[model samples]
Target chain A: MSEFQNPKARKRGLVIQEMPGEMLVYDTETNKAHCLNDSAAFVWASCDGVNTISDIVREFEANSKGTVTEDFVWLAIDQLSSKGLLEAKVEPKFKGKSRRDVLKTIGLVSVAALPIIASLAAPQSALAATSCNCSSNSDCALQAGMCTTQMCDNRGMTPSFTCVA
Target chain B: MTSLQYGQNFISFGVAIRFESTNARLLQKAVKTANKALIGNLKPTQKPPEHTFVFGRNKELGTFVEHNGSIVAENEIERGVFKYFDSYLRVRIGEYCPDRVFVHSGAVGINGKALLIPGNSFSGKSTLVLELVKLGAEYFSDEFAILDKHGRVHPYARPINMRTTDGKYRPYTVDVSDKADLKKRKPLPVGAVLFTSYKANAPFRPKRLSPAEGIMTIAPYTLPILVNPAYSIQVLHEVMNGALIVKSKRTHAPRFGEKLLQYLAKVM
Candidate 1:
């Protein structure tokens, strides 16, 4: 929306380094590295700057087989962008490779907001993987990577996480 | 397996695990510090029944743990569930067991590869790593897993070059035999690295550690300089050696073994 990007900015602004058991983001401005452990890595990768924050939230829904709200994505993104790691790029020009992904007709798809899933049940080694049966955002009480064996959703979501009986 | 009240401060709820293959110097050092520093801090409580715990089923280990309320084991693999509660930490062992790393404290999990188990105790490191082999993780070594200057995981030993569960400690096992023991000696390359923290809510999260962060995490673990200062320098260089590093949360066991196996198969 705003033409604030510098034309001569180098690509030296962001660096992603994968080390033993960790993911790190190096910010040029602060000369500091922000680390993302295992679960965070999954979120960081799908937080594509090209997509609106809502689009990225949907990506996690698809990945976790769960749904979450637009606000969650915005909350996550705003925090990341505030660190100067994310930069807005001008929309790419129409190119031949882009055509392969889809028909170019402009259209609209219904976007549903899903709540975080927080299961408290302890994980069992033999439980069957349930299909994404969630219908709304309220179904997910657990956010992403919860420790303690299972999810911790007390209300507003079905119990999925395993806990000590 | 007798209780000699070693410390006034360190109160152990659930079970207190002791290493049978005793390296007295290290044990005494750890215990003595607890005795001196834990006077006002130690508090004993009823074992939380919900704090479900497990240990090697060997009759010998069971007897020892029963008498001592602590299992003294190392060099042998005990694939079972167990939990330990302390004031500062609650260890869940044997969930998704971590892979072994060759460092000053003994074997530990590699940083960022696919193994899911992380635990305390240097001796258990290699035994748990052996278990990682069962989950389809590439076998490294049982002892002295090393970090190269380029940040790659190298083998410090082949099989676990540590002590074994011999003598009176033999009954607590599904397989009570001399051959099933995890003995010391050998090295291999590490594909992943992990930094482990002990907390209850901690689940298996395989993460990628940044190079500088890797150096920081490896610092405390690599402290007291196991070999020469050069070895630590070598470890520092090796931490940056290009393998993956991760931070893990563990309690009691090779926690998160099955789930980790499931997750790693897709990632690595």
Candidate 2:
């Protein structure tokens, strides 16, 4: 496993929304929404296949208007990887180092918090349930009105539902 | 082609629900109820509906809604009806709303600005909004705060859907005289976003949340934020800009409502 592979980061069908100092990414694949801090956003944006770990660090420092080590960039990468936001999974580089140790190594530069990505499971739209093709009940489990039984009607056309319990 | 006869009824926020039922009376009642909820004091929409929900009910299956043509809900009529309505509003409002963002929160206009209490269904949004309404704040909505593109809150005042003593989702019209009597108040800029939930014996403790925190906290309860994330994010950023976002936990709703007004007065 290329643990040190420069992360070829591309949001997995995610749409990024920028706030005053943070970013909210809607992961279309997982239906989860993630909040990226300024540093995390910078690191994520810089994680193009072309940029190496050092490039991320430099970008973070420049964008955050502060100093952070390779650990800061790694921390963001770790989070993005864990959230499945990255197109290809990259192993965490902090093999022997802990978060506290990395923080201490980087020292307390200037920032509200370390680059962090916080997320929550988002609620789906109501019509998301019957809006798909299904053959069994479990297919509608994640939908707003979960299906108890699924039936494929009209052969190739979109499956219509009788009811949901 | 099972001869499932159905008709469409337009609802609030430019959504339409199509119902299929053998019981003509039940279907008519449901459509009437939905229309009453939609056109409260406002003119009926002439625009065609954008989405259609096909629901059916019978003796053996009791009541059920079909998604695509498959059964999604069954056995409970009230549950099925409300589920259909909730799903339709949640989906279509966000889908067609190019101008507003929907928050699953209770909103009230206090001193010319909107005070929004954001939470999930069981998070005491309706109860808290009702309490605020009794305290002389004009009710915007108990279920949603439809925030326009300019960050102002509009009234989506469907009769405050509340759990009756018998544990049914009945319309609570304590503040509004009739279910169809909706107030056509001008949209107000959001003064504060209160992220609160009721707790037993927990004192009202409030902590200020940053705009990002506020958006993140309310994202789950917001419609279209997940489906149309890009537009949702843009709308939310505008909707939450310059608004005070406070996370509070309280046991007493009336006391919390009073304190909320006091807090808004100071902040706004």
Which sections of candidate 2 miss by over 4 Å?
A1-5, A62-64, A95-105, A108-113, A124-165, B1-12, B20-23, B37-50, B55-59, B76-99, B162-173, B177-184
Once model 1 is optimally superposed onto the true structure by TM-score, how far is the C-alpha of residue B23 displaced, in angstroms?
Answer: 22
Evaluate all candidate structures by whole-model CA lDDT and list the values in order: 0.36, 0.66
DockQ for every prediction shown:
0.05, 0.27
Error of 1 at B45 (Å): 54
What is the TM-score (0 to 1) of chain A in model 1? 0.39
Cα lDDT of model 2 by residue, B15-91, tens digit: 44355566676566556545554544222444554444455666777665554466544554455455445445354
Model 2 per-residue lDDT at A41: 78
- Alpha-carbon error at B187 in model 1, in Å? 6.3
Identify the leading candidate in terms of lDDT. Answer: 2
The lowest-lDDT stretch of 10 consecutive residues in candidate 2 chain B is B37-46
